[model samples]
Target: MGDDAPVVERVVESQLAAFNRQALDEFMECYAESVELRIDGVVAASGKEALREIYARQFSVAPVRADVVLRIRQAEWIADHELIEGAAGGPTMSVLALYRVRDGLIDQVQFFGQRVTE
Candidate 1:
């Protein structure tokens, strides 16, 4: 683990906590101004304003939450295997989210998710 590992973990953890709480402002605080959010290898949103718009819509529509089932950290990167419930009124999902932290803020995130059919 590098010295930045803890910083990466802390920033990611904070983002997770904010998301789970449905606190969009707090969640946004953990991200950089020029952040990128990707889903299934596609760029879903770029920059803080776009991120806010996306999440704001989601937050107003449904009660979504994510719980991390497993986490792996390496230097400035953290990967989380998460169980997401109540996501846009859809089935539960298992998602693998990879996050990259830079200068104490999460600058990029990639999420790959599948419907949990159990």
Candidate 2:
């Protein structure tokens, strides 16, 4: 743990705790009310309400659990891989995410790559 551990936890917990119990509302609390979210450089979602709409439309058939702290770098940023375990013992989906934090909240999340089944 470095000097920024508390800040890291603030951001990370806001991210992980929110989604712990299959609660979308909880999952989203990790973000600021005025967050900017982008996926694949195509879809753009700003603000929590808009994100709610976007999240509602996007669904996955796999089980995804957050792996937020694969590595936490400077200024409270973390590079992590989210693992999605699916049925059939088939493949796992892992999404590497980079979160930018401010004041212990996620201001922006830039992530890419489809779920990788490993």
Candidate 3:
């Protein structure tokens, strides 16, 4: 479990970097073929194909160039999984994510996100 922490942290960091760059293909590479992405405690997407569509649409609509302000408030390995708490100010969302990694790929993600309005 201790050894897995560093490896999992790297994977999570890679994914975040890809996402911030809007590199869908690179981001997808870190995920398993049958990946599951839960949003706000709901199964928003499953499988690489579905996830691809979601990201594609998002990237298409996003600004061509923008700064990424995503911040990791806390991160830890628990019960063979990585638990991450973060926030992205652009969307004003508080993020709670649990990642299940296997074979160096992110197999499942349980995400809890909520909009924050000030």
| Number of the candidate with higher lDDT, 1 or 2 | 1
Residue pairs in clash, model 3: none
lDDT of each: 0.94, 0.65, 0.65
TM per model? 0.96, 0.71, 0.74
lDDT per residue (tens digit) for residues 17-118 in model 3: 787688989989988899998876788888989988987887767532222234332334212222222222154554556677777788887766565555
Top candidate, metric TM-score: 1
The ten-residue window of minimal lDDT in model 2 covers 56-65
Model 1 lDDT vs. the true structure? 0.94
Separately for all candidates shown, the number of backbone clashes (residues 3 or more apart, or on different chains) is 0, 4, 0
Reference-based lDDT, residue 110, model 1: 97
Per-residue lDDT value at 97 in model 2: 70
Q: How many steric clashes does model 3 contain?
A: 0
> In model 2, where do residues sit more than 4 Å from their true spots?
1-3, 57-63, 86-91
Local error of candidate 1 at residue 38 (angstroms): 1.0
Backbone clash total for model 2 is 4
